[model samples]
Target: MPLKSPITVVATSLLAAQALAVSVHNWWDVPSDFGNIAELQSSIRVPQGSDPIKTYWMANGFGNGYMGMQHNSDTERRILFSIWDDGQGSKVEPIRHGDNVTVGTFGGEGEGAQSYLVYDWKAGDTVYFRVQANVNEAEDYAEYTGYWGTDGQTWNLIASFRAEKQPYWLLEPYGFLENYGSDQSEIREGYYGNFVMINSNGQHHTPENFQFTHTDIFNEYREVWDQRLVEQGKEVYMRIDGPADQGAYPPAHH
Candidate 1:
């Protein structure tokens, strides 16, 4: 069975301290003509036994189209990067079709990508993620690669896929921390940090290089590690907390 959803939250005592706050944001909106984003990278740490029944993708994007991670159950996780094609979602599949990674079909045949086993994720360990997109004009296809690592330097190729007629750069670069599960009287929180984006030209951009258009916070109910909690728009720090109504928006404070 897939792992529980990759979510976050805080305990009652922790909440009382006000030391824990949930925050999420849709940062800088990258233009589709940004000459094609070559690669994007980020890191996150989930505390031990801090599981909530929701999905959380530390970083995600969508413009003409997009790709990202979805936390299914504790055992089932996926690195999804897709483009609109053939009236169906053409996603990246796994390098291997076994445990840890496998082919997933949802909407129809060839609709899902590599599903991962995230429930076994080591507690307090920082996992690094990288996604690369390249255009293959000869075939008019866009190739994408998902890489992961633990040391923060060495990355293992997780999966690679191609989408037809998706040659344009994807827009909307943002970090997401969510508790899609409806867990009132509690908040799901995760630590997202060390974000970097590499354009097709190989130029690096960080929070220090851009302004973030903050979205997805509903006051005390939903918040981010912003000036109210930490340095604003630092990018190195972010959080998502709430009891989402149908796994989309956050609910009011309990």
Candidate 2:
């Protein structure tokens, strides 16, 4: 069984608090020329001061679902994987799941199945995430598998879900950071890099340039950290919350 994670995750928690917090999101897209992709792998490192409670640092997100790590309640940090319904009337079903992991249905943020492992993923440590699609044309569904680990090569199988109207590839891969806690001025940052995409035809692409996006919150709050572009758009830097408008070096810079 490949259910064990290469990096051991000890359970830990943060004192959860609530009030008012801004949700900041960013995206990275692969070159359109590469075309339909079957798998997308990336890493995220929420630096020392960047990781906060009630934060979700999404690494690999597609048209249907997303897989990443989250800072849940005071006693639980998780490696989470969630997927919404097929939208054409078929709900996503869990075909397989890892050990000591929770798998079930989730509502509110679109109805779907969700899974997570209570692993104490520390801030400043890099965690890698990957999502691969296995399409069954005859069945008219695809089994999408989620994996996470410290090293890019070894991965722990988070869960596998069957999504209806599932395509042959993971369409529109992206990454975003979200803070769900109530802290209006706390700095939340995530460095998303080391992007590797494999197309349906078995072509590999190492994408470096990532474009930035600002949500509607930026229009309302107008926080300086919400302003993303750092140096000539070579790196995609996203900071949500705080008054200072400063930039940092890209962790994925090679």
Against the reference, the lDDT scores of all candidates come to 0.48, 0.69
Question: On residues 1-254, what C-alpha lDDT tens digit does candidate 1 reach at each position?
Answer: 22111111111211322333233445553554455567777766655444454555555443322334555565665554433332334343334422365444443212334334343455367777777777666655666666677777997665566656455443345555545455534344445556677787887765343333333345655432231122454433333443444222232322
Q: Which ten residues in a row have the lowest lDDT in candidate 1?
A: 4-13
Q: What value of lDDT does candidate 2 attain over all alpha carbons?
A: 0.69
Error of 2 at 146 (Å): 0.2
lDDT of 2 at 43: 86
lDDT of 2 by residue, 107-131 (tens): 6455678999999999889899999
Model 1 CA lDDT for position 60: 41
